[model samples]
Target: MLKCDFQYQHADFSLNVELEMQQSLLGIVGVSGSGKSTLLKNIVGLLKPDQGYIQFNQHILVDTRQNIHLPMHRRKITLIFQQALLFPHLNVKQNLCYAEKWLAPSERKFQFDDIVDLLDLNGLIQRKARQLSGGEAQRVSIGRALLSSPNLLLLDEPLTGLDVQLKQQILPFFKRMKDELNVPMIYVTHHLEELEYLEADTLQLNHGQLQHN
Candidate 1:
């Protein structure tokens, strides 16, 4: 289970939310700048809340009152953004390998070839990050995140800017990934069609707060 009750205030906006979810894919639906990304960042430990706590499967990642905070890496949560954000100096294969060291000793769940095949990146393995198209780069990024065996996977508008043709090409792999992985996921998007595809429960946020319980 995941439990989050936090509030973060910045110069431009404030985010306040409380949620408790299980091991299922949950969609965080909101428009751009609706604090969707901000909420995910706080859960991942990038932005500490002014006063609140987050607990994932009984492990406390943050508790401002207790003065406890865990670094992003140790939280076992992976956040994928709008961009692939791959290492500019590395090839597609190398970018995936960069996350291998973070895997647990028993977590040989997915290997290089498995990921390559899963994301349909067989031909682009040796190519540089800059050489791949938008959809391809995002696929690579997802593969890299999977290799680390994250407990909670968060995606922030991953389909943004891609054309319909590109989205059609890339969405199947996402469906496959969701079906194959056992980890819980929070997919953030502004598109209603994405919800139809994901069929996950929606947690709608407006401005900086959840619209319904």
Candidate 2:
């Protein structure tokens, strides 16, 4: 579970969002510049809120009133950006293995090989990041994130760049991750159709607020 009640200000723009998530998937639909990504960044400690708090499960991540702010690396959180953002010099397997190095064997919830199988990355293992197609790269990216065994996953418009065919192909993998892996996720997107497939608890972000969609 996750709870965030924060007010963040960046020069002329501001974001005030408060929401609690318990479901496996939580979707936030908003137009560009509507503060969806900003909310996520704050949650993961990439950006500290000017005021308010964030708590994950029973742990406090940020509580400005108490001067508590957990660093991004210590949050046990993983963020997948709009772009695949894989390391260009690393092969698919190497990129995936990168996450494992940071975690102890016991701390990991999933095996490396299982992630490869689930994400359909067996053949792409030897391919360098640049050699992958958009969809392939995204799949590898997802595999890499899952391999880390994050307590929470944050995805920001992950399928935005892919064509409809590719999106359709990748959506099922996400569904499988939700249903089979049961990982909790906060998915932010401009597309409502994507949420329909995930069956997420849907919310809309409009002018610094959150409401049922």
Local accuracy of candidate 1 as per-residue lDDT tens digits, 1-213: 899898899998999999988847888888888998999999998888998999999999999999999999788899999989998789999999888876666875677788888898889989999988999999989989888878889998899989999988987877887787677889889986886697778888998998652
Candidate-wise lDDT, in order: 0.87, 0.93
Candidate 1 lDDT score at position 178 = 79
Among the numbered candidates, top TM-score falls to 2
* Cand. 1 TM to true fold: 0.94
TM-score per prediction, in order, is: 0.94, 0.98
TM-score of 2: 0.98
Per-residue lDDT value at 38 in model 2: 92
Residue pairs clashing, model 2: none
lDDT of 1 at 59: 97
